[model samples]
Target: MELDDDSANGLLRSFGRQVQALRIRRGMSKAELGAELSYSQSQIGSIEIGRRVMQSDAIDRADAVLDAGGVLIAMKEQVERAGFPKFFRDARRYEAKAVELHVYATQAVPGLLQTADYMQGVIRMERPQPPAHVMEQHITSRLERQKLFDRDPAVSMSFVVEENLLRRTFGNLDMMREQWERLLELGRRHHIELQVMPTACAEHAGMDGPFTLMETDQGQRIAYVEVQRVSRLHTDRKHVRELELKYGIIRAQALSPSASL
Candidate 1:
């Protein structure tokens, strides 16, 4: 409930209110609008009260149905950003625009490479777990970030993931199998490289923990790290260089993409 008062929540609430107003002006009941939009009445209520975020296609449908004339369409970006945790919105922005990205993962799989079930399993691990709606928002935002994979001029990406992390059953064996399949599927992509770091290695450059290095098309370089739920984005050249060097060593230590796959 307290989360509904945050800046992100405020944006969602504002969007919801506008949708509600438009619906009312068109002489539509929640039930009727729900039918038209292919959502349940309760789902519409959840959206109208800002308890849920609607998908892009649904929003587009609602805009046309309500005669919003692009008003609702325009808020798409802001509403989408509201779906992520406050600490991560900035990091996702930089990651999305990266011309070249390298990741050294020690904990879970990087978000870009995760399956929906894996994301759900990871979300369940949070303390004082987020409400159901929050889970939807987080997952939605995560799936959105993966659009980076299809970007034209396709962003070059690589990840050095710890070997043992892949073996853990975050939820169940079935879910882990799906995730493994996903990894194998993505590894076949020409622009993405997946490496697995052996846990038996005596020395590891990334002992400091997981971090990512990103280089945007503009030539801007940055480093990102997160522990617990807190994250920092480093823009200072020296700090970025240290992480960059660590990633290079990590890639070397890990099995090559072909062997790892």
Candidate 2:
């Protein structure tokens, strides 16, 4: 099915088109596919039209029912990744392979460190409201990304968040407290270091805004910067080096990891 509005990201629309075509080729109607998957026909229709976020497991279910020989299942990662903003996709891919991750967060806790309730609060504050399903999918995908912390041959990770993030109440006082406790727990891991930039700092290097620097196992470095809705991943050697220097300074200016908690 050719989508009239191409506004949705290409990966999402492509996944939807592939699902619709495979179902049709197998002599299955939307209703039949829904019945097989235990979803309502309208839910199936919404998925086919790219109006609904496809849950991770739904891809496997579709693959089995349509007997697509793993074709649909192979697209699961890309489909789930489509839940995030377009600019963030490449960074997510790089993060998965990074040997070391350095982050400087100015406004809020980094996504990987955020608790579910905290994430929901952030999502609810978006200017234009996202549909409930979309919001849930975003939350699910974000949580899935946190699995990187537990992967074998764990990645070395460091974060320097502004002190205000801990004080900022996202959902409620309880939620903020929980988020702080989670950060404390994460900091206890040998592979992770958590620091806070004090509000009383006379000067800081991260005034340029938040950015992440990632070093791959092969020693290649990349830098990512996001502001407002625009984000970019920097691969240029000189640019990445500059970001690395700035991050080093920011880390030095932040509170010691042992003192942060």
Candidate 3:
């Protein structure tokens, strides 16, 4: 689904702000809204900030409870576009509303948790020929995408990383150590789960590469597969279903979530 680039981002930001405004206009505190909808205060905050995806059920309840305008309901189609690509403008839209995210990365640490220094080193190595400013822009964009994890209450995130990522030198040894430590901190968080797939793990589906699967509130799911320079979104029923099964298996085969670090 092609979208006007600016329109997509604008709509997303507006949707997030509107949700928060609607709740406030209705005199609904975050806790009250959560109580009414069975969502935690943090979950509600994430949804309001557009750092998370809003579920259809949540929308319906919001409209009824807060007497929201048909604004959000009308935006559903665009919201679906959030699952359209990797590194896509819509990916953030999809992720903002996701209640859960399961990811598998074989080549590198997940982008959301990567440090600026680590990202800069990785970008320099991968695009050594690019001009300095070009590399800086790329690095800046990467850092901006990380705001997804900064929302209050945080999103429920699970990562399955290949052991190779730990040994890969993104920059200098010191930077690699810092990156690993960052990963360890994220791993210990209450809402984050990190799993490592041992190098010796028998051949598996993820051997092909990294992918992320996100589940929205209304139970719809989207799969994002990334390659070196391109990422594809799998929205077809059969493709999505197949990935779901594969992801379940990978999660089971990977090291226990606690030991991934």
Top-TM-score structure, candidate number: 1
TM-score of each: 0.89, 0.80, 0.64
Error of 1 at 184 (Å): 0.5
Residue-level lDDT tens digits of model 2 in 61-135: 899999899988887877766776666767877887899999999888999999999999998988797778667
| Runs of candidate 1 exceeding 4 Å displacement | 1-5, 27-41, 56-65
Clashing pairs in 1: none
Ten contiguous residues with the weakest lDDT in model 1: 1-10
Worst ten in a row by lDDT for model 2: 1-10
Cα RMSD to the true fold for all candidates? 2.9, 4.2, 9.6
Candidate 3 local lDDT, 76-170, one digit each (tens): 65654431222565565677677878888888888777998987776667743555544543554566556556656577888988898889996
**For residue 60, what is the lDDT in candidate 2?**
82
Judge candidate 3 at residue 215 and give its lDDT.
Answer: 80
Residue-level lDDT of model 1, residues 160-187, one tens digit each, is: 9998889878999999999999999999
Instruction: Report the Cα lDDT for candidate 3.
Output: 0.73
For model 1 the local lDDT of residue 254 reads: 84
Candidate 1 has a TM-score of: 0.89
Question: Which segments of model 3 are wrong by more than 4 Å?
Answer: 1-87
Q: Candidates 2 and 3: which is better by TM-score?
A: 2
Q: In terms of lDDT, which candidate is strongest?
A: 1
Name the lDDT value of residue 249 in candidate 1: 86
